[model samples]
Target: MTRSQTTLAADAELTGVAFFTGGDVRVRFRPAPAGTGVLFVRTDLPGEPSVPATIEYALELHRRTGVRRGEAEVQLTEHVLAALAGLRIDNCRVEIDGPELPGLDGSALGFAEALRSTGVRELDAPRKTLRVHRWVRAADGDAEIVARPAEGHGPAAAGLRLEYHLDCGPERPVPPQNFRCEITPERFLEEIAPARTFITADEIPALRAAGYGERVDAADLLVFEPDGTVRGNAPRFPNEPARHKLLDMIGDLALLGCDLHAAVASRKGGHALNRDLCRTLRAAATRGDAPITEAIGVSTDPAAA
Candidate 1:
């Protein structure tokens, strides 16, 4: 059975400090028409410039995902994107009053809960889905991500599967962990949304020196200590780090702007590598190099694809 596109039924709001800018920000999630995908409107800007949440507009930010259109940009977008994708929300207008999104709990749970409360409304159009026909891979040193076709061609097989292998190295503060799950709303909310972003304790000083995370504290996110313990927080799961990596991959892949029917495996992959994989997929779709199927229409333009 084909699924219809969906959007929020009513407006929802979230407010908190941005991890990077350390400034208070407010974001409003509003319903959008079918095919709108996810668009971020910078309400604080003069014209309230909007940026489509697609690979075409993605920015290569450090440790986070962002998108830009001319002078307007939205930073720290992974959590929001992950929430929307995990819930299968296809169209949304995310209006924000700041440059960065709220860093609530350093996880997607806040956004997921708000969106769930707002309710999801199905649109009239059939949802677009990209079924990968060939393997696509991206790598950087030891870190890598690979996307490939799922087995069979039935509706049951037309879902996403993700596996992450987070090898922090034996000497690192965090231990190696692995997580694999089929992407679904219930699974995402229960197993993935609450996993908080984490960093090594030693990376804090350099982040501070780079003028980031000024207002963030150990309570905001998981800070792994040298002795393989979290500072001021308990692990949500024994493999919470790997789960968070999977969450990040979900958000980054949302830039593809369609339902992805593929199994993706990531080993120590980060935002840059994830974005690269999206670019590769987008290019393939544009060139008709991949045997992709669409429920409605797929953009062929290089800028839109």
Candidate 2:
């Protein structure tokens, strides 16, 4: 069965602390017409400039994914975008009164639950879908993300699948973890949405020194100690970090502005490598090329997000 486009049935609001700024932000998700895609409206700005949630508008920042329009930018948007993609929301207006989104529980659960409560309505138009006819890979030193055509399944039968591998080194705080799964709305909520964002215990001081995560604490987010133990929180899954990485990948990939049918594999990949791949895909789509077997070069600089 062909899927129809979707949007919120009604408006919903969520307010909490912005991840980096520690400022209070209220985000309202409102229904939008078909083909609007996802848009971020800055209510705090004088004219409420809107930024399209697409690769063409994505901005490169440290440890986070964001989109900008002129002087307006939204930071730490992965969780909310993940929630929207997990719920299969095709078009909506994400209105916020701040520069960053709230870090509710450091996971996508809150956003997903709020959207579920607001309800989803199928739009009259058919959903937009993208197909990968060949392999495309982007690498940034030890980190890499690859997208390849799904084998065996017909063009209409195949759906998006994510296989993620994470390693912070055996001597590092977090242990090696890997997760592979098909990404469906139900599966995402049940398996991926609750996985919280994490940071190493050693990085806390640097982050605090840089004036970040002011409102976050050990109990509010995951903090892996040097001994591979959580500081104040417990892992929802044995390999929660890997799952969360997949969650971030899904969120970042949503910038494609349409449903995608492909098999993606990532090794120590984060926002930087993901964005690079998105840029390559957008260029390929713009050129209307099929079977783009050419390898897209990845950045060699190390990054974490």
TM-score of each: 0.97, 0.94
Candidate 1 per-residue lDDT, tens place, 229-280, comes to 8999898999999999999999999998888888999998999999999888
Evaluate model 2: give its TM-score. Answer: 0.94
Top lDDT: which candidate number? 1
Assess the local accuracy of residue 241 in candidate 1 as a C-alpha lDDT between 0 and 100: 90
By summed lDDT, the worst window of 10 consecutive residues in model 1 runs over: 289-298
Report the C-alpha displacement of residue 17, candidate 1, in angstroms.
0.4
| Positional deviation of residue 244's Cα in model 1 after best superposition, in angstroms | 0.4
lDDT of 2 by residue, 124-173 (tens): 98776777778999998888999998766564446789999999887898
Task: Report the Cα lDDT for residue 172, model 1.
Answer: 96
